[model samples]
Target: MRHIDCQKRISLLVDGSLDGPAVREALDHLTECPDCARAYEKMVSLNNALTNVKPSLADSSLASKVKVRISGESNSAGYAWNFSLLKQVPIWALIAILAVGVGDMAGKTLTETLNMHDTSHNLENLIQDNGESLTDVLIDFGQSENGR
Candidate 1:
């Protein structure tokens, strides 16, 4: 086996997972190659160090405390206002209705204040004039308006 392949198998050998003819080949390579032998030694040392470590939890009742806190928050009645009736109504429909009502009232007020008839014709003219250059529109508007 190549020195590189033997180096990789060292970890499997350290973990006792390497088997059959592959183990013999890796061991033979490790004996002849100083670098592969050093790699094998390091792998063995690392495996032994990791195996000797024991982990411990800081709080034994942490899981139960977290569950109790979550349940208490869900059941708590701290809210002063209830929006159940508001939730039952469609909020978007309400907003659209109010917007239409306000727009109609403002349009009527503007038309009355302007003392103008044929609002649709005026709206069409404005739309058509928007397609022209600003200077041309201003010149036409100036010529058509009565002296003020």
Candidate 2:
């Protein structure tokens, strides 16, 4: 038998459920295969430990109750299924959101800067001109009231 076949039958061997021929074959394989020997020893220890455990409760077999409890636990609580896809959300989505927010903030900052620049230019021109041409005023005012 293959290692896998021997492995599958190992549970039966550990539980003492195997027939005489199977027992002989398993022992023969154990003599040759160190990996199977280790596995067999582990299973033997687990079985011994399980056999030694005592039940505190009255009127119930410990092994059967433990089996039922394990079966229920496996059936009811194991293998949680989720359709929410929460784990599927990409880091790129967060990065894109961050990029869009930063771009919007940058655009606002640039627009405000441009508006300030335009306002500053207009104010400087107003200050320099003083609202009237100096030469026109000078020519008119320089002429005397007697039309000189």
Q: Which candidate is the best by TM-score?
A: 1
Cα lDDT of model 2 by residue, 29-106, tens digit: 889999999999998998889789966677558889899999988766544333235446688997898898788667
| Global Cα lDDT for candidate 2 | 0.78
- Against the hidden true structure, what lDDT does model 1 obtain? 0.76
TM-score of 2: 0.37
Question: What digit string (tens of lDDT, one per residue) describes model 1 on residues 44-148?
Answer: 888889889968678869888999998877666333124555567798989999998788678477667455558767777674756788788778778778554
The RMSD of every model to the true structure, in order and in angstroms, is 19.3, 21.6
Question: Which candidate number maximizes lDDT?
Answer: 2
C-alpha lDDT (0 to 100) for residue 110 of candidate 2: 64
* Candidate 2: segments with Cα more than 4 A from true spot: 58-148
Segments of candidate 1 deviating more than 4 angstroms: 65-148
